[model samples]
Structure formats: C-alpha cells, structure tokens
Target: MSDKPLAPAIEGWHTMGDQPHLIGTRCTACGTYFFPKQSHYCKNPDCDSTDFEEVELSRTGTVWSYTNACYEPPAPFVAPQPFEPYAIAAVQLEAEQMVVLGQVVTGVDTEQLSVGMPVELVLETLHETDDDIKVTWKWKPVAA
Candidate 1:
C-alpha cells in the first residue's frame, strides 16, 4: 500500500474507491454497451446512430477466458522492476452481457481460474509515480 495520493493509471476509464466500476458507453438506439467509452459512433451494424450515453458498467461478471502475461508489455503499461507474470481475464459483465478484459489481482493462480467463474472489479496499485499512486481496475475471483 502507498501513502501517495491515488490516481487512475488511465484516466476516465474506470471509477475509484471501495466499489469501483468500469465506465463505458451505451448506444442510445440499440442499447448496446461498449467499453473504453464509445461516444463516437455505434459499432452495431444495423445502427448508424451517433448518440451515446455514459454508463458505469457492471462490477461483477463471469470469467469468459483467462491468460497470463509473462513479460513486460509495451508503453502505457508501467511494469515493475523484475516484472512478475500476471493473470489476465476476459470477464463477461453481468449487466452488459459483454466481455471486458482486465488484469487479475496479484497472486491469483491460473489454475484457480475457469470459464464462467464469477469475478468482481477491484482497485489495486498498478505502479507508482513521483506524485501519485497509479491505480487500475483488476478482476478478483468471487469467493464461493
């Protein structure tokens, strides 16, 4: 845990606090949801509407898939020194019915994950900067 003031690693992508949620947009016409906040235009083939509204996507979901990152990724991701492999999961949100990818919480094993396993969003320190503690959303398994 860091005493530095918390800040989002990628601003405006998700909320912060005890109950953080991924911020996304919903197509006003077809009621479709998109992460990364799709305000430009709907990707739905049948809908050419440019109208969209911001919505806080569901925090709980089932794990649609899982994998691990064995090496440091490209920029925008600040990996720690002597980087440790981390689990990644594609979770299908309970409300949106869409899969959103995220890093799994630290120390969770790949063998512990499974398709359709329930999970929830949680905030964790991704890395630290001179001025703030960079936080990001992570998927944590819901204890049965």
Candidate 2:
C-alpha cells in the first residue's frame, strides 16, 4: 500500500476510527433509519415528511444470520489474489432492529459464529490501491 493516509472505501457511508459507525439517514417524521441513506422522498407510508438528518447508527448488533462466501465475487468489487473465502453475516442493529450485511473480520468463520451472538462494527482493509488503503466497516464477534 502507498504511504497515503487511510481512506474510506466508500465515502460518506461510514466513519473511521477505533469506534466507527455507519452513517445513515433518519426520516424526521417517523424516525425510520435508512442504510444507504435516503435523501429524497420518505419511504414510510404513514409519514409524508421529506426532511431527514444524517445519524450515526449503532455500532453493535447481534448476528441474525451468516454464511460462507466460497467463490470470488463478480463485478465492481475488488477481490484479493488467491481468492480467500470469507464469512459474511447479516446483523440486526441494537436500536434500529434493521439487518445490515457485511463481511466478518478475517479468521473467524461460520463455525465460530452463531445467531444472536453479539458483534460490533470495526474497520478493515477492503482492498489496497497505489493511492491509499481503502478501509470499510466489518462485523466481528464482540468477544473476539
């Protein structure tokens, strides 16, 4: 990796630090949270208000489901050479109760994870380019 400072793989989606949070937008009317943040019309049927504000979502959640990715992903994604298989999980946020999917941190696998197990948000290297070390949020067991 180049000497460039660490940067987010996808800007404006999550923050960087020892404690990171997914940046989501909440509807001002119904208090509904959106992951890929919605800035346009509110999706809540009962609430017509279009106003929204960006909020840092909960950094901890429980494993709702998980699976192993044994094949290389296709398209715009950058997969490391040798195609290392990894475990991915859908965790339900503590407060929002919405499931957000992400790759589990390296080393831990499906056998080591179970539903309802607590996990926390963490930053990990997604891929490296000559420009910078692209970092993204990942879910890892809270005890690990």
lDDT of 1 by residue, 69-128 (tens): 998999888899899999999999877978999999999979999999999999988999
Can you tell me which runs of candidate 2 are displaced by over 4 Å? none
TM value for model 1? 0.94
Candidates in order, TM-scores: namely 0.94, 0.95
1-144 per-residue lDDT for model 2 (tens digits): 467779999999998999999999999889999998997888888888889999999999999999989999896779999989999999999788699999999999999999999999999999988888999989999985
